[model samples]
Target: MDWSQVNWQPQIGDPHFMGWVTVLVYLGCAILAFKLSLNATHCFKQHIQKQRTFWGVVAFITLLLAINKQLDLQSLLTEIARTLAKEQDWYDKRRKLQRIFVIAVAFTGSTTALLLALYYRKIIMINALALLGICFVIAFVVIRAASFHHMDHLLNQYIAGVRLNWAFELIGLALISANAIRRLNKNTRHRASVD
Candidate 1:
């Protein structure tokens, strides 16, 4: 396979289109998170401190991820890898080892998060988010494995353009936004009834 013939640039489909869409979704979710934070502060005064902190973190993280996706951080990492490979003959081996390490860490972290979510199953949103996190981890693993094995065709086909992984990410962000809105509406109704 001619590596030079490969389209390294983002194209009109899977990944690029999906990536931009994901960015938009993340932005909306970030907005929802901020709104949730405000509602927590103004309406849910009983749990004001905890709710505000949680929603604030959600907003921050979602906004950061939106920026990261827009920037295409994975491509940047790939460029860094290519540059390091040019400098050192051992870079390829080191890169493979690094990939293995990342996979291990992702597996461990996702498992721990899932377990914690199970323990806090009363929080429906946490369970949903944890499941989404697991899906992201699985997608990451598939992409990494494809890259390591020189399965560029598979990566490009399933993971790159209108990428399944990016779709999962967008779905997760949308879920967060939807859940936040639902909770806010519920709280608002409760407060109105009490008043």
Candidate 2:
């Protein structure tokens, strides 16, 4: 199998299925974001800038996972073989570790999203969601750091323009969480003053 000679089409391998899932999940997140932050701001029309920003961050993380599915080891090997003028993976020891990470994150994300739906007006839920994100990122980074050689030198190499996107997403999540905390504090102060 000549990887160099192989054609890398947009519909390559499992990306087709995973890409669709990503799109659907992102769209769902966007809708929920609008609803969650609808009353966030003092504006009249209900502009959830905070929620919008948060969802964008969520979309970025989910995007990374979704993209990882198709661009993983087995699929990339085929692409590499096609482009490199030969095939590889003789030992069948493809790193393919991204699949595990994706499964973990997806399960956490989906489960939390469903739980959020149940607690639409609860500030505690937002705090819990932020904690969940923190745990997942920390666990993943620790695990990956420990098992660095499993995948290629850099993770998410197969996807274009998604490099370090998860980092940015984490930063965004932190910022929004801070804002939510501030808002919670201010509301508490106002209630205290009234009492």
Candidate 3:
């Protein structure tokens, strides 16, 4: 496995209909999250720092994930790992390594979610759906990273001409967007009452 033999080109993992739809959904969600962040800033006005921080974090993560949806950064990472395993003559043991990697990722994601929950406990009730949406997207990403053949096949399958992956991705984005709209409305009402 020569290093020169491996192609280092960027690969577009999904370029089809569902892929584009998913990307659009991600972009829409990112915009909503950003709006939520802005609303948090204007509504709190330096009083509730936690609210500002949480929405800001959500906006950042959503924006990054939206970019990643089209760039397919995960595939690049997987390719690098695969190439390294081959070069190191450990390609045969990739399955074990992949399992370990997936487990580590899942643990890290869960831990981060727990920390966020604890830190934002005061607002969790209001943002619970958005949090759940974020979890779904993260779970979808982790499952894709696991790269199991059967899982890939399943995700590729169509139900009523709709890809499973699209459904999973959109559902998460929808939840986040819904939560953002709800918050924005609540904030507007509160401001009106204050005025």
Q: Judged by TM-score, which candidate is best?
A: 3
Residue range 1-195, candidate 2, lDDT tens digits: 443465554553333544454445434433333333433442222434544454445445545543543454334544563344334433243334445545665687667666655543334344456445534553444344334354424544544555443443344345434544554455457557758
* RMSD over all Cα atoms, model 1: 6.2
TM-scores, all models, native as reference: 0.65, 0.31, 0.89
Q: What lDDT score belongs to each candidate, Candidate 1 first? A: 0.60, 0.45, 0.80
How many clashes (backbone atoms < 3 Å, residues ≥3 apart in a chain or on different chains) does model 1 have? Answer: 6
lDDT of 1 by residue, 1-195 (tens): 334533345533234666677677878877877887777633334556556656676778778777766655555456556555656666658757667866776787678666745653445353265245434534554454325544444444564446555555556665677667776787688778879
Ten contiguous residues with the weakest lDDT in model 3? 39-48
Error of 3 at 65 (Å): 1.4
Note each model's CA RMSD in angstroms: 6.2, 13.5, 2.3
* Candidate 3 backbone collisions, by pair: none
Model 1: how far residue 99 lies from native, Å: 3.6
Best by lDDT: 3
RMSD of 3: 2.3
Better candidate number, 2 or 3, judged by TM-score: 3
Model 2's number of clashes is 15
